[model samples]
Target: MRMGFTGMTLDRADHLRRDEQALKLARMHPSARFLLLDGLKPVLAPDADRLLWVRRSQAPDNPSIFLGLDEEGIPHFALAGAAADVGGIATDARAAGTRLSAPEAGIVALARSLLDWHDRHGFCAACGAPTRPVKGGYGRQCDRCTAQHFPRVDPVVIMLAEKDGLALVGRQPGFPAGFFSALAGFVEPGESLEEAVARELWEEAGVRARSVRYVASQPWPFPSSLMIGALATADSHALSPDFEELEEARWVSREECAAALRGDGDWSAPPPLAIAHWLLRAWVEGQVPPS
Candidate 1:
């Protein structure tokens, strides 16, 4: 299945990013289009899943972030600053995902991630100096120290632990009642993916992971994260919910998990937009162990 935010069709033309003249010419292209966003929410068509785009003349005067060239070589740009009254419905990331197509979602994810990063990192981290966008919004250069900064994506491990046909699911305090999803944690420095998975499983639910196998990945742009989906074999079925991490944790059978995936049971798995849903579904379909 095509995961959400995975199939971006843009050329990303890394070569043009560094060429000031090329980028300027692309922006001046007759077919150049600009995507509008109100803060982090993307403006969409009022009645469809389509992203609402406008010509450069209609976009804000603020500097625009060059997204990339589309299949037809048409330059596409996203507003670097929040748009005030660009007529259209602006929706949050989750709603936008359901409304937009995969390619559109991928575009939105990239735009949002880059825009957010720029907003937070307006100054040099090494020295107290103002930074300016360079390389067509791909990097920032400190004005005083000449320090260079680029967009960073934090790695996260989201995994499902399985044992004896039962998978371990957990719920955070903020989760809706009866909603349980795969356990996840950010991949820390110097930790391997497998080690992160095992450590998170053990720390959150007291479930030790015997072995971990790669499943799939998703670009979660809720402030930019690459979720590495994995499947692990649990050494034991014991439940130990760490209030600090999870409000509750338990093991559920394949049947129960399927029901949750179908939204037919008392509890529901993560929404289809989440990688956790795919990870759990993969396990329920018996595709993880790989015979």
Candidate 2:
């Protein structure tokens, strides 16, 4: 199952950074566009299809982050400003569905992540001095220490544990009854993807995974995170919930998992855009080892 926000819309022209003429053309070109990003939300214009795109002057006066060039060779930028600055609707990036083109949606995610990084990193991490954006919003330079800082993406491991033709899915305390998805946790320092998968499964559900395999990955830019999807063979099926991360876990058959994915079963599952849905479907389709 292909997921949204997987495609790259911009060419990310790094060579033009030091080229004044090329940079000016990219900024002053009539074909260039700037998307307004307020914090993590994007300014969107509602259409009959509800696609999210708002046109502004080629050169915006506000401090803008230079996004990459589109396939047509048009430069794109993102400006962090108020929603009222434009007549369009300011909405969350998640609303970009069929209403918005896939490339546009992917760009929105990139804009949100970049703008959010700049928002929270106004000060130097090394010295306490104030920092200014450089490299077209890619990094910040500290005035006092002259240190350069770049944005970061957090990695999270979301996995499905399968054993004896059954999948282990669990939910937290506040989830709707019978609503369960893949177990996930942030990757700690010095931890590998397979190690994080096994550790998270054990800590959340008390399930020990003997072997883990890489499945797929997705960029979940809700404040910037890379979701690493994995599948593992369960070594034990002891029922124990951490109560903080999960309440209880159950082993559901592949047939029941299929019904849940179709939204016709007793329980509900994650949506197609979420990597968890793909991981579950892969297990049901026998793409993962089921011992």
Candidate 3:
């Protein structure tokens, strides 16, 4: 099966060896490279002179640090004061002047979230103690509590619900006109991926689903989230959209969905980079059509 969007598989191999090497490099070198991301988009050609270096509020003894990822999949470590501030990078991306490649954007998302986590998680959750970076910046160690805290990637479920020849699509109030997408939400605590999928559908669009099947997943490090793709069979299509979550919800026929995916219809869907676009395309290609 061909993976959608950039057609790049950020698989196991890409992250395996680089993580350890990155941590070691960070420890040995006092200066490192950093990338910034705004949402899924990355800010390229950042002005290194304007980076922000945050010190640990709790650990007065811990050195201030800089954020950066290495070419070998490792993140760089350095003491603070080497770079300027963080706003310039984000501002650059927003101004439409910077252009970033697909993989580069993905890596930037990874670096931004991981570094942000390191900055915020200077304290151990297990006990009221300060934590130090370990495992090449992948984890932290709490000296007082002897606990290890790893970076976290929250999982979100994004699904396309189908019934008969139509697929369910919805729109939140603030979405651009003529735009609709698969319903989605963060997986809550103590819920399996399947349960989260079903719940989000019902909560957002008032649609109950069955036969929830895992389709694909994407690393959405807008702030460290994993988007889990799924296809579900709608038990009923009576869409009473929850006004709080969704402004409108409805079923579109396969033909209509196909046109939306192709960007030739009255309505335009999300771009190919988003998982919602892939889910809609999967329906049009009959890869995940209604049973």
Q: By lDDT, who's the top model here?
A: 1
Better of 1 and 2 by lDDT: 1
Backbone clashes (count) for model 1: 0
Candidate 3 C-alpha lDDT tens digits along 120-207: 8988887878888765466788989688888898999999988877889988899999899989999999999989989999888888
Question: Which one wins by TM-score: 1 or 2?
Answer: 1
Instruction: Let me know the TM-score candidate 2 reaches against the reference structure.
Output: 0.92
Off by over 4 Å in 2: 17-21, 48-60, 97-99, 289-291
List candidate 3 stretches off by more than 4 Å.
1-43, 46-99, 289-291
Q: Give the least accurate 10-residue stretch of model 3, judged by summed lDDT.
A: 51-60
What lDDT would each prediction earn against the true structure? 0.87, 0.80, 0.64
Best-performing candidate as measured by TM-score: 1
Per residue, candidate 1 scores C-alpha lDDT tens digits across 127-243 of: 978899999999999989889999999999999888888889999999988889999999999999999999999899998886789989989999999999999888889878799
Q: Which stretches of candidate 1 lie over 4 Å from their true place?
A: 80-84, 289-291
TM-score of each: 0.96, 0.92, 0.73
Give the higher-lDDT candidate: 2 or 3. Answer: 2
